[model samples]
Target: MSQMVRRLNDEIESTANMCVRNGKVELLKKVAREFRVEQKSFLEHLEELEDHIYLCFLTINRSRRLVVRLGHTRSPKHQFTLQELNMFYPTSKRIEDPGGT
Candidate 1:
């Protein structure tokens, strides 16, 4: 599963690059369509990395960076470093009985 995600990540990065270089902006949807599965699975990694970054940075710089990209900017190449890396898994869990049923 991880291998698949890595492959997809590569594909996504390459495709995004192509979009910026050749200005093939329309190809994004197709590229994203093919990379959905990996994106969905990569949420945990994204969250963990974000937590680590937050822990590492203890200044106004981090907040400023986030604020700059705080908008519906779909153009991934422009956002670069702080693109809102979305992971499509449910992070919240429900409370239930701890039974071996």
Candidate 2:
């Protein structure tokens, strides 16, 4: 009877240990899943930032080309007048009046 009781106690302790180990494994899996979600979100944000940077570069290049074209004027000191600059804007967006009047 004493031997049987000892065997039962040992079995109970072993079972408890297994339960604790399984709980730890489940906790680790949950942490790993959360980390993966955060990583995916960060990558998505990075892609959006890259796209915005690419668009900004395109805008800068376009501005540089326009400046180069304008810099080819025959006169070295030829400053662009408001009228000349207005020609570059669409009629709808052109400044109607520089002064309050």
Candidate 3:
């Protein structure tokens, strides 16, 4: 009877250990799946940011090209007055005379 009890206890302990190992494996699988999902999301955001950066670069290049073309077309003697420059880019704040003279 004592031998039988010992055998039963050994079986129970073995089963418990197996269950613990299986639980750990399942937990690891879940964590790995979540990591894959987060990595995919991060990669998607990175791709979008790359696209946006590419568009910004294209816009800057186009603007630079336009400036170069305009500079070539305009006569060297033709100077832009402050009023003419302001017509293209208006100041948000009025310029106040510091001297008050």
The Cα local distance difference test for each model comes to: 0.60, 0.71, 0.65
lDDT tens digits, residue span 28-49, model 2: 5665578687978866876787
- Report the C-alpha lDDT of model 3 over 49-68, residue by residue, as the tens digit: 77897888887787677667
Using lDDT, rank the candidates from best to worst: 2, 3, 1
Residue 10 miss distance in model 1 (angstroms): 1.1
**TM-score for all predictions?**
0.28, 0.48, 0.43
lDDT per residue for candidate 1 within 1-101, as digits (tens), equals 45756997798788799897897877877766865867666677877776776766744566556556554454545553312422211235333334633
Candidate 2, superposed: residue stretches over 4 Å from native: 1-34, 82-97
